[model samples]
Target: MESVRTCVGCRARASRSSLLRVVAIDSALIPDERAAIPGRGAWVHPTLECAETAIRRRAFVRALRVSGSPDAQTLIDHLQRNG
Candidate 1:
């Protein structure tokens, strides 16, 4: 059976494959396409709206359990580039 993950932004449970796995890189959020990055990861949909929502609500830091604010530009840029 496939694993299910929850989206920090939308707060919806979804298949792991349907959500994008993001990890902190230098305190900034980055997409882990292969979901192989180390450390804590926060899941979100591959869309700018979700990314923005996550940032606005500080979901990344809460979900990843990191200190301070985590940058979301890299993830936003990534979603924009690939969108």
Candidate 2:
């Protein structure tokens, strides 16, 4: 079946294929290119604004069920590379 997920940043719902999956691994936020990584994952658009908003709103940890500040370096780099 087709997968649909809501972006934690903009709270916009989009197909899983269209939205990027950010997974929490080793207490860091890493972009899941194939969306196959196990563990808590949150969906978001591949835009910096959404990322920043998600961070600002403190949505990542909640969405991913992680504690402490998550290292979003990978996610940031991914957005930079895509943008």
Model 1: residues with Cα > 4 Å off, grouped in runs: none
Report the Cα lDDT for candidate 1: 0.91
lDDT of 2 by residue, 7-75 (tens): 999999898898899998888899998989887889999899999999989999899999899999889
lDDT of 1 by residue, 1-83 (tens): 99999999999999999999999888888899999999899999998998889999999998888889887778989999997
Best by lDDT: 2
TM-score versus the correct structure, for each prediction:
0.94, 0.93
Q: Please count the clashing residue pairs in each candidate, in the order shown.
A: 0, 0
- On the 0 to 100 scale, the lDDT of residue 59 in model 2 is 97
| Model 2 alpha-carbon drift over 4 Å, by segment | none
RMSD of 1: 0.8
